[model samples]
Target: MKFAGIGVLNAARKTIARMLGNNEIAYESAKSQFWVVDAKGLITEGRENIDPDALPFARNLKEMDRQGLREGARLVEVLSVKVVIFLLNFDF
Candidate 1:
C-alpha cells in the first residue's frame, strides 16, 4: 500500500481472502471470480439459485442467447491477473 496506497475497503477484502483461502482472492476484492469453464458467463457459482447480492461482482457469463450484459466480464478485481492489467482495470 505504500506506493499505490491502500483502500480500507480493499484491505478489508484482502484480509477476508487471506482468511478464506488463496483461491478466494477475487472475492476479497470487489471483482468476480468469474468463469468456472463452460458456464457461459462470469458467474461465481455455476448452478444453484443465488441472490443478486450474494455475488454482486459476479458478471453473468451467460451465452448470447441468454440475457447479455453489455459491461460483462468487467469487475474491479480478479485474482492474480498480471500487475499491469490489474492496474489498468483498477478503480475505487
Candidate 2:
C-alpha cells in the first residue's frame, strides 16, 4: 500500500508540474521526493502529497490558476470539499 501511495503521489506531482509549465520532472523514488524544472530551467521542489484519496484533485489547482482564482496559486491551504467547490465555481 505504501508503494502504491508513492506511485499515486508521483503521478499527481507530474500532472501538476506539467501544468505549471515544467519541462523536466525528476522523482527520487528512494526518498519519495520529486522536483520540477520549468521552461527557463528553474528547479523547484514539488508540493507535498496529500491523502491518497484526494491525490487526483491536485490537478484542480492548475485549472484554478487558468481561471485566475489567485494571482498565482502556488499553494492550497486545505484540500477538501470547500476547495473542490471553489475550484469548480470560483470567478476572477
Scanning candidate 1 in windows of ten residues, the lowest lDDT window is 82-91
TM-scores, each model vs. reference: 0.24, 0.24
Model 1 misplacement above 4 A: 1-6, 23-30, 33-67, 72-92
Task: Please give the distance, in angstroms, between residue 86's alpha carbon in candidate 1 and its true position after superposition.
Answer: 20
Cα RMSD, each candidate: 13.3, 14.0
Candidate 2, 1-92: lDDT as tens digits: 11223355456667766565654533222112332111121112223533343333333444444544432233342221122122111112
- Residue ranges of candidate 2 with Cα displaced over 4 Å: 24-92
Q: Write the per-residue lDDT of candidate 1 for residues 3-40, one digit (tens) a residue.
A: 12224334555666676665645464424322221112
Model 2 worst lDDT window (10 residues): 35-44
TM-score of 2: 0.24
Model 1: per-residue Cα lDDT at residue 46:
43
- For all candidates in order, the CA lDDT equals 0.34, 0.33
